[model samples]
Target: MAFSDLDFLEENFIHYAKENTQSNYANKDQVPTTPGQVKMMQELAKQVQDYGVKSRYNEKTAFAIGCLPANTAGVSPIGFFAHVDTVEYDDRFPIRPQVHRNYQGEKIILDEANGVFLDPAEFPDLRNLQGQTLISSDGKTVLGTDDKAGVVSLLAALKYLHEHPEIAHGDLYVAFGPDEEIGLGGQRFDPADFPGVEFAYTLDNGRPGDFEYETFNATAADLTIKGTVVHPGEAYGLMVNATTIMTEFLAALPADQVPEKSRGHDGFIMVTDAQSSVDRAHVGLIIRDFDWDKFLAKEDLVKNLVDRLGQKYGPDRFDLRLRRQYENIYNGVKDRPYVVNLALDSYKKAGLTPRVQTFRGGTDGNFITKKGIPTPNLFNGGGNYHGRYEYVTVEQMDKLTEVLVTIAAEHARQSQTGRDERPLKKYW
Candidate 1:
């Protein structure tokens, strides 16, 4: 079953997505969900209610809402999460998002007048968005698909569930948070506010068909390689090229494991920061993999590389430090096999192959799982996140809503007495 009707969401969503002068701060798209976005979400909450799922503004900009089957047969309660804050980007101006006729499997030229283009070559993913009226920014601006797509999909799912109350489901918790891009989304989240099942699905992934049970074991590694400054002419053997030595340090780690070179289940070493001059140089790194043991091994290898390099160059020449930033989510959630396996089935029941994934970066799900809410990240039908070339398929958004509906129905069935089966309420 589908939403009773799409016009309500279509009309209000379009109106909500394109508001003006809302940019409160600098060029940062800072029109925070404060009073404005929260207002829109509150308006959305009025459309449906089961538990104030899209409830109201709390500490940081956040809103909650719940959708449930109107009948008694519906079982299980689960939360579906997505963020509302758009990332700080360039020129998100006067966006004239236009919809085409019935998506005839063709390319759309958003606005060719501004010397910008969205063609098939640069983004082959467009082929999958065919026959769907895709929403995007005009050529000169960056489309806010990093998460607006997710917001819309969740809203659409709620809209659909409300319209077709006959669909089988239990309590469905829905949330849209703020400041996620700023690393603070999880800071103010009250799992109690979205209380029900112990698990949730964050509809905020890179592409359709993406279901991630795990993410890289992430940590920030900083190493500073010091060198003495001497006159160029006197810089013979004594002059350790900090830049050259840095290159050797890079080479010390495995070459093929870089993010650009690695893929499915492949671990990698990423040097996110590198800067140098004749006098001094500093380098930073992040190690990643889906497996906890392998991830730890990688971090050890990096520490060993830096230690050996420090030994070769002496303590004066090399200073190193490592700390655990955010860790992988699999081990924490793996015990609750239903957390990942059920989601895969939800994806399939929605007619998409869930590509159980490993993130190249960390997400709120990584932290949420640790917070005792085995939340896994799911797709929002967008690609090229945090950039100008980003795009999300309306079809993908539709499918994602279906996935949300499926999970809610299944989760409630697995629970007892309308509460989470796992030991979260007390522990959390």
Candidate 2:
């Protein structure tokens, strides 16, 4: 079934975007970290039931799960995920999505009085979206297009399949998860929620043609330094400055290996924050690498540097702690090449040239893949994400819906005929 329902996609996108589902990192201990996300997830659970799927909202993980039963026999189930929470934004202003119908490729003033404009010069991708129904923010706040577009696209796909039951498909599972922007949602996802599902896709971010199976392997590091304090007049050879020690530790980090200096396929160690006093100092950092060996080497570098400093000063003067965050998605899917080949084939069937690229950052797919379900990221159809300039088009979202439907039907066909077991190409 060709799903061309622009109105359904646009209406749901706009309705959800205005709901202020921004996640709170300060309240990370909370299930969803915000009440707004829970409200939306609950509503989505009920909404999916209208399309003949058995749906429910899981309170523990804050994920709304739905299952569409298969019409075909002996086909394995597949799943798709979309996050409901957006990134942290200014709460003083409310999100108000502005819709432009049949865009003609001109600069749009998101707020004329505030002098905020979405110009084509600043965002060249806007030119490619001409003649499509474009949606943007009011320049006062974000439009929440990052994953909301993904949510609406999934809804359109589900609605399409429900309306046309003749299109044969295997069991389809959908999950509307929370806190993806803050990196907590996928970590809590229970693979048991998706019974019998072998693989899945995360409709997170990218253009319509973008497909990513590789992401950064990440870890967080915390360093604490202790120093002796004394009065300056009587502190000769008796006082050790913690700030000075913190500066030395910072200087030891490789300058060339940082986010500012790194790009495609390169790994980096970044100091996210640092604070120090005469008595104590603390440093927080994160490490990201596509290669597991390089990632471990980076971690070793931190421990080695701290050990050297401890020997120089004292063993009790410095303490370092490292925590693994998420592993690269490629590590899980490399052996299962069919998971990738099927999506690329479905993209081609939907008339989009496959543009496979490495995602330099992490996604919900990272954690989900670690839980034994190989999930990769697909496009959510938006530009300038996580800010006021964010925008998406009805046509781009429609393309995503088509891709979702194609994947379900194609997976069933391949199971009956033969699976695409093509060797996955190295895309670094």
Candidate 3:
């Protein structure tokens, strides 16, 4: 009684997972930052057409856009986003996906030589995946399940809808984006591609029932400290050590408000990287919070710290640049509760108990929501994302497909009758 083809999900996930589409931050200036992503996006543009979707590859935006026209009227266009790019991994070994059929919750060895094994005891979630077809990496490289599972699930849904013409639905827009791992993909998304689309969902990493509307309101900051360097023998009063200023700035930061200390609804300011020398110093940090006021406060704390240092030294010596990365999806969806209610209702119809939680990290939905579309995140059904331990189950992908199909059909029905307008609960 599966909604879509499980074989299709399994076959396609493995095929796409084998390709190295790891995004790079260093070459982020490029549209996709890597050639492999373009190859996959372009292929996807052509592949989706086989499912009766009108597709195109937008080189400017690096998004493979596909549209399945509505069979019924009155329902507004909705979009689904799945990034083709994955987090960077070692390239020495190609990604080789290992399929374990009818998994019995045993300790599955990925590579005995490397002592790499996925134990159900260590990952208790694997125990829930018993009797399911589990897919994982060969311990040499990533399986790219962070989103390949999402991509295939969307495809399976699209294929199922195409085959069953009797199913009523509205225009279904799908965008396979590039460079999401580096946080550049969604920023480059052109809303024009999904014309008239009011809302969207990003199928990113999570368990099957996971639904996230509130995500981190993120901001990145770069600080540069300038110092006057003098010869050590004559440095008595002339030498101003930049490293010392950087140390003071770092110490001034709220030590309690860090990633390890902060969890659940709490936010954190994390110093990602830092380098210092007597002559000059540079520090890179990022701020994140689910609450808008708290998010801004974190940014202000950094700015105030720099201002105090400037007062002690000289105003010209301390230069800090703060940039907003993305805002919480709650900001965009709060007024329009239907967007969330529709997904939750559809989840119930798909036999899933909606587990709404505040996302600790940001996704493509964050940027898309800021672009006038109230975008939230739906689970792609996987664990250990962005690493060798990453894995996904075929049944989980099938469940995601079922949820998507139900959402489309339910959306059409709701539009004709009445829309769900239930208010979203504050998870914090």
By lDDT, the best candidate is 2
Q: Assess each prediction's global lDDT (C-alpha) against the native.
A: 0.66, 0.94, 0.93
| Backbone clashes under 3 angstroms, per model | 13, 0, 0
Which of 1 and 3 is ahead in TM-score? 3
Off by over 4 Å in 1: 1-4, 19-54, 60-76, 121-125, 128-130, 163-170, 206-208, 232-241, 382-384, 414-428
Off by over 4 Å in 3: none
- By summed lDDT, the worst window of 10 consecutive residues in model 2 runs over 1-10
Q: What are the clashing pairs of model 2?
A: none
Q: Per-residue lDDT tens digits of candidate 1, residues 1-428? A: 33223454344445655642122234234335345556655655665554223354453435544545334444545677777666655433643455553565465676677655667677787766666666666665556665666777777777666666665566666777665665556545777776666678787866767877677777778988887778889988778778877888887889888989988678788899999876788999978777778888998898788778877877678877887766677757766776776776667777777676666667777666777887879988767776555665566667777777776655545443343324222110
Q: Residue 43's C-alpha lDDT in candidate 2?
A: 95
Which residues of candidate 2, in runs, are more than 4 Å off?
none
TM-score of model 2 relative to the true fold? Answer: 0.98
Give the lDDT of residue 122 in candidate 2: 93
Residue 129 displacement (Å), model 2:
0.7
